[model samples]
Target: MLDSLRKAAGTWVAKLLLLLLVGSFAVWGISGQLVTGMGGNSVIVAGGTEVSATDYRLAYDRQLSVMSQQFGTRITRDQATALGIDNQVLAQLVAGAVLDEQARKLGLGVSRDRVAALTVEDPAFQGPDGRFDRNQFDYVLRQVGMRPEDYLTNREQVAVRQQIVEAVSDGLTAPDAFFRALALYEGEDRTVDFVVLPSSLVEPIEDPSADVLAKWFEDRKANYGAPEYRKISYVKLEPEDIADESAITDDQVAKDYEASKARYTTAETRRIEQLVFASEEAAQAAADSLKAGSTFDQVVAAEGKSMGDVQMGALTKDKVPDPAVAEAAFKLQANEVSPIIKGSFGPMLVRVTEITPETVKSLDDVKTEIRKALALAEANRILLDVHDSYEDARAGGDSLQDAATKLNLKVTTIDAIDRTAQRPDGTIVDDIPESAALLAAAFESEANVENDPINIGSNGFVFFEVEGITPARERMLDEVREKVVADWKVAEVAARLGAKATELEKRLKDGATLDTIAAELKLEKQTKRGLKRQADDADFGRTGVAAAFGVPEKGVGLTPAPTDGGQILFQVSEVFEPAGADASTLPEQTRTSLSQGLADDLLDQLVARLQAEYDVEVDQGAIQRALSF
Candidate 1:
């Protein structure tokens, strides 16, 4: 169940909606008041509302587990703390509590019926019939370690927060003037004429003397310093390593195939579209119209219904909301339409757009797959015992090697490697499994400290003990002489380029044209025409684009380029403002987008006001203590 709980925590409902269920952290405003004299189990106190430590821990653990699964490694508590998961989870909880508190003050009471309706409406708790199923709801709740009451409470909070958001942003709209101004800025284009200053055009440099090179290396020793590397020995236990040892008989494979026969069989299915009507007479009239050579589209349009208003796309028999609708729908051939059939909703006219024949595989067809699956299952079961045995041995103070030997597992050791899994020669160490996890644990643990075991995906566990530590040291000038000289040349060239670009910029600011500057400096003039404010040009990247829009017409600016010690000295030749007529031509999508942005700003301001009125107080110590578990 813990494994099930972990896997469920990463689902879309838990990771996305649960985080948003409490509203964003930006919704909260807290004063400097520190609420004291609370029990250790209390995390936040919003007016009379208190969020419990148990709920906070659950949220924190879910987020931590999700991050670990995403990065393909075990994330430690220290890593979670460093990543600020504690603060993020606590902030969401506090904000949710604050909203609930404010809602209560305004006499906003959510009925249990409302929460129950939302629960029944959620797709997460729906079965194949596309309707609410109590069994499914309970199963999903159990998977995420939540009771029905707790889940409903979360849904109620979400409903309340949504009410607050709606109230704050109600009837919000961006003014025409505001959109016109934004359009002028966003849609404006610019033409720029520029000249490049390459390092190759700079004055040539001679090789530095020994004293100069040594001084340069001394000044930047930290850059040339060696990163700390650890020497570690580890024991890895994988189900794959023990899979071949687990023998599977043909009888067992056949039994497995029989038990999972559904996986080997496919039922015939139809792609259906249904139009449901409220009454029998309306449905019969529509069906009669279709029979009288009127197209379905015409019939729907005559009834004042758009295609989207009535179309239910692509459902199989079991997926149809009404059993009678499913039966009538499946009875039709491809491209065939059915007469109005009595449905749960009312009357439904179903159409079959496509049909798929049934498919079934014989035992011989998937014998190899079944055999492998059986072997893997057996191996996984054995690995669980192996993990427990290894832990017992470690608890008894046995060495990693001794524990491995006792469990008949091999122990692999790397003589010298860094956290990047690289040797001194920069070659990757391939033999180590779960190298990232092992390295993180090794570096965090002191030398000779017993390392905790980390889960590797589903069927493996790795444990390591750090044997030695080599403190990081700075290399002498002679040690990396070539790299030092190369770095020195780069810096010197950049400094010269910077100075040259500055001189040109000063001359342009002194009222010289780009053409004159290019001719004086013996550089080629480049022109970019009709460049939008946010457009990314191959000639001018984001930096140049920003400069083009930022500088006034006929003003000069400099942008650094990724090319070797390169710079672009440009003058904005023309600025094009959006015309008044262009605002009328703006697309509805653009208008909606701008309106949403303005509404978001309004909502933020409203939240700030609400926070001031609510007087939210968070117990930092209590939150830290709750998350420490």
Candidate 2:
């Protein structure tokens, strides 16, 4: 009932009500301290409707809970304020109040019987048997900290608000001219004749003199500066680090293998084909035909059935639907047909096309697997003890290295890594556990601070500290001379290519055929047809395609190629307009989208008008007090 109301109300009222409904269900039991702190204050007042401070707090806490789940951590009040969640909650509450005030002024009311029917039909209150259960209804209300009377009142308000929303925006549709213009814009096609000018066509650029190169380096020195790097040292505690497969005795391996024998066994299966008939006489006649040297394919074809219609791929006996069919199918050898069997559906003839025998692995085949599983299980059992011991040592004032050393654990040190976990030389620092989280924590810590361990799920922890820092600095020209020269060459080539493309575009505009130009330059001339506005092609990239469509038929344009710093010189050859179909006959999905857009516009206008009439007000002090805790 609420979901339907939300859809009918469009976005403004829909979003406001949705947040209220979600908060009511997801957040529970506001503290008495907060209620007392808020004392007699209303967070928002619009006309005759008022939102109490308690309501605002409930909504804000629910949004915070949702954000914490998304980030896998708790969110502080400061974080919520930074995210603008506090303001957003206040705004939603104000919108709801404005709508409620308008509904009250207009005297819109829903019948008690209608509200009762919607509650009983709500799936949230349904039981296992799919009918409204009194116990489930009571339990859900208690869980959300709402009384039955309060829930019904809320439901009644939603229905009343929906009446106002639907009256203004229901059955709205976009004008036919709007859809026709959109269709023409989207469906128009183009054809272009083009030539590719590769960078190789440009003459080799001469190297700059020493003075010019030095000046170039001075102008762009910042581009060659090195990024700040940090050296991080960490210790990881994982189950695999302590697991000892060799310590698992042969007797334990044998016992585990015997207990889990089914894991190593494969059940027998057979490929079966079945043909069901209405009566025993029809089935027996078909079976007799197979016995008289007629092939199964011939009998199946005579019944106007294809092989796929009857083929049931390899399945175990238990997987077969009918017990009678299962028993008979296993009894027959490969390529043998059975007489009419009374299947669950009807009398049927079955044939076994192939058989696979059951096979059990020998103890030696899986001994190592069993041993490793047992060893991992044993390691998991004692991982907590190791974690506790390390914590105890830390509480006793031991450094990360000392604690790890006492436990015989290895501490890994990365010599230098940037924020992206890359060395100054641009190679990735490999094999860091939880690199993203670890690097984020490492960059935020000082060299001597003892950071808390990051829990890598339920299995392990990574304790890290920053060991050293390298401040970023400008690189000397000599250190990056080779790269500078290479980059200069690429820029030089691109500039040359742009000039050549501009010259070619002018020649084409002056009535030179692409074929003649291509023949003169010994380059291939290609033509692309049926290119839509959204076409993605290898040679004619998005920019090139857009250039093509921007011009009228026979107009010339140029753009750089999607790859290789090449250029495309093209002239539009043809244009295809959308077919002259009735614009009213738009696709159902397109029509619904346009209608919803129109509805949203109407709802926005209505809400704005109501806000102006109701004179909505917000109490920032009350909001701050509610969120202070």
Top of the candidates by lDDT: 2
Scored by TM-score, the top model is 2
Predicted candidate 2 versus true structure: per-residue lDDT over 1-629, tens digit per residue: 22333443343333333534532111111111112233457877777888887778876765565555446799898888897767666655655666789989888788999999988987777889999999988876664455788778778877777777778776778888888887788889988899999898885977877787788889999999898899889999888877889899999999998999999999999999998887888877888888798998888887889989999889999998889999999999998888888899999888999999999999999998899899999989998888889889988999889999998778999989999989988899878999999999998899967888888788899988898999999999899998888878788889888998898888888988999989988999999989999888777878888889999999999888999789989989999987884465568898787877777677666666676777766666787777675
TM-scores across all candidates? 0.54, 0.64
RMSD of each: 16.7, 9.2
Residue 355 accuracy (lDDT) in model 1: 87
Error of 2 at 629 (Å): 17
Model 1 per-residue lDDT at 56: 82
Query: Superposing every Cα of model 2 onto the true structure, what RMSD results?
Result: 9.2
Model 2 reaches what TM-score against the true structure?
0.64
Q: Positional deviation of 305 in candidate 1, in angstroms?
A: 57
Task: Residues 122-231, candidate 1: write the lDDT tens digits.
Answer: 87878899999999888877766677888887878778877887787766677888767777878788889999888886757667799999898888999987778788
